[model samples]
Target: MDFAFTPEEERFREELHQLLLTNLPGDWAKRGLAEPIDSEERHALADLLSKQLAERKWLTMAWPEKFGGLDASYLMQYLFNEEMAYLDAPGGGGVGVTSVGPAIMMYGSEEQQRIYLPRIANADDRWAALYSEPGAGSDLASIQTRAVRDGDEYVINGLKTWVAGADRATMGWLAARTDPNGPKHRGLSTFAVPMDDPGVEIRPIENLAGERQLSEVLLHDVRVPIENRVGPENRGWYHVASTLDFERSGVASYARGKRHIEQLVDLVKENSTLSDQRQAVRYELADRWIELQVGFNVAQRIPWLQTQGISPNHEASVSKVYGSEMTQRIAGTGVRLLGMAGLLQRGTDGAPAGGAFARHYLTSAGSTIAAGTSEIQRNIIAQRGLGLPR
Candidate 1:
């Protein structure tokens, strides 16, 4: 029941913290985690920081040594993610490192592994998860995207929406239907698709925060070699499910929430006007801090379960649902504390915290929707965790 990290893990955390402080731009905090990198300079800075992290082999530390990683423990990877999230640092490798790379390791062929794993570990290419389609998001089994076999290649045609980082990705970890006659879940297959291939189009989608970080990708008659298929044909549903489990651990979300709560506390303490309502704000902040800790503890269990050779399913759902909903609650509390000023957009003259909380308030609305909806997570908890009759 010991909750403390080992000495080596603590040292690694401190080293990563110092590395981020030294490498990040001075004004990086001002931009805030809630705001997307909208300018060329910010994009350049993100690219630079990503390269620096890759050089340190911290981007994919948990992967095997043969795949250009340090073979670090899962707990170490969790610590790394927590540190990066707290700082809002770039170069954690996004889906490329977290979901796609692990999925490839578990399901990809030897040739596919050799071709893609190193590039992912080295940050040579950004990858997007092309799974959710216009017609199929929460009900992923209903996806209509098709990848029909055509001799030595597969001809793909579909529209994938809500793809984060699609505009910047060099590759796509795609899921498409390969067998229409089978059950919805059994008919799907996964593929490693080149983003630059013919008939692939990426269009940005602006969210409530006015950020185009999410995009829609259109594929029409796009041809990839049969070698690009990752898992067994007509069995991609299970592979996609596993990939999502990697994403749902929610450690980073809790860490990010912790940072935001700390900033909110500082804002309340420093502002004379906010100090007038100190008692109420103090109670709210305390509640938020406590909830964040609870969520973080829930998230930490996932890595521990992995270390024990247990695949966390319902546990991951519990973490994701709590963390994402906690985010929304924290954002709501921040806006309420800021009063009318919370409505002010970023870059405004009198906006508080550079309008970070306002931006977060808008973006947090989607926290419950992305990855899987809150309702979906609840179902997982009920059916898988509680053993409820469905």
Candidate 2:
């Protein structure tokens, strides 16, 4: 029940901070580099930082030793992530560390492990995920992308929108239907595909924030070697879903929220705000801070569950939904605090804090929808966590 970091963990956090101090661009924090976005420049900068994280073996330090890791504990990995978020560092797509690498380690061919793990651990490659389709997003069982087996390969053909960081990805983790019959989930399969294949195309999509946050991917006659399959054919639903645990767990960043809260508090304190809501807002801020702390406490429990070899399906979902919603709430509050100025985005004259909060207000519109919709997470909590009926 202890909430404190051990001395060693503290040391590791300090080490990470030192790494950021030395390796981050001189004006990195000034450039709004901490926010997640995808552009040629953003990805390239993140790629460099990721490589730096890899050199210290901190990127994938908790993985098995044979696959380019040092066999560190899960707490170390958790601490590393906490530091990254606290500093607002570029976590990139994190597809490699979060889902792709773990999926391969669990269900990939030995050859697949030998080929991909080292590059991923070393930050020599980036990966995009193609899971959601136009018709099937929240319910992945409805995926329509198809990969038909042909001789020594599978030919992939379909479209995937919102493929994060596709512009910088050298490869993609794809889920497709390999069979047209049987249960909706059973006919699917997973594959690792080259992002630059002649039959694959990636185009950028701008979010309301006016930033290229996602990409639309088109695949036609994309041939992937059978050797690239992650698990047995027609069972990709399991392989891909196994790692949703990874996605669902350990994603909330209390540090980021805490930092954001601090920023707003400092702004209000320094300026003799005009409105009486300043005092009222102070109380509201305290209540919201308490909510964020609750979310953080919930998030902490997931790491403990992980260490104990438990998944806590509902607990993770609870944290995920709460954290996503909490962030959106924080951004909304910022918009209200800034009033008309809040509406002004960056690059406009007199936009406060370079209009970061305004941009965040727009970008956060996607937060609840990304990993899983907030509503979906609640459903998970009800059914899986609370043992409610389907």
Candidate 3:
């Protein structure tokens, strides 16, 4: 099979690169892509970037032309992500455009689609995942966040922890327990809940990098309209399973990780002394590149699966587990190569890569933890893909 993009795809890539050049402020995109933004800064960047992307109709490129997207091919989507990550530009927020948007497109009602899709497209709204309770990390089915049906509303009650990007989010793609009597996995339901609802409380959790990139969200009788629900009432496991599948399929996993691999190689070349040290680092970097290439190959399978009307569940799980762990290893190796300088914090006088390596080293530990852990991915691979006994 041909791995290279066709001439038409090449033209699309050129056009997308030009769009990034013309619309994105170079310094802003560079910084935004590289570092996690503070609440105010995130809002500012979202406003500016959303407006710019909306003006060019670039924000919704993966959607159909009727929904304001350019009806771009999956290859174009992959190309756009590669270009964005290569430049260290935050091309699209993962939770919004990648995971939730597709879920909405698939499960949402026509009216719901019209309302939310444009908001997401314009960057007028931002989303955070409301999964992973304090008690339910790897075992997502054990989530106790309750959503009791009350007349036309569902009263959501429980706490969700380790929720990334919830501080600035206007909305949440929330999962809550709706059927206590059903099987653990069967009782769950997913909904789009407003983050600012009076019953919802958000408390920030600081990370090793001194950034409030995570949140503990308490939901107390937070009433969600039943219409806001996605898919069937109690089939949320399927929704989440499908969403995780989408996350696994995106090019961002490989694209973003590969950019860091390149950065690590550059750091090693610039800083390493002995030929042995350089050679060792070069070999490790090459190995990381190969792992990332595997992820890229998996990403290429998504569109074909979509066309074939398959969920891509097993493939996505494989990519997410392998790709995320690979990123952590590569980032940690970079810090080790830096020796004493690796621990330098950002805003400190004369830190390497503005202490970017330090940030990555600290945060990479959680990369495997977030979304789904390595162990969880392995479970998916064993049970779902290999048909091993659970």
Q: Who wins the TM-score comparison? A: 1
Q: Candidate 2: misplaced stretches above 4 Å?
A: 26-36, 39-41, 91-93, 250-253
- lDDT agreement with native, every candidate: 0.88, 0.81, 0.77
What TM-score should be assigned to candidate 2?
0.95
For candidate 1, lDDT tens digit of each residue in 159-220?
A: 99999888888999899999999999999999989899879999999988888889999999
TM, every model: 0.97, 0.95, 0.90
Model 1's TM-score against the true structure: 0.97
lDDT ranking, best first: 1, 2, 3
lDDT assessment of candidate 2: 0.81
lDDT of residue 197 for candidate 1: 86
| Error at 59, model 1, angstroms | 0.9
Task: Order the candidate numbers by TM-score, best to worst.
Answer: 1, 2, 3
Look at candidate 3 and give me any clashing residue pairs.
none
Q: Candidate 1: deviation at residue 69, Å?
A: 1.6
Native-vs-model 3 lDDT?
0.77
What lDDT does candidate 1 reach at residue 208? 88
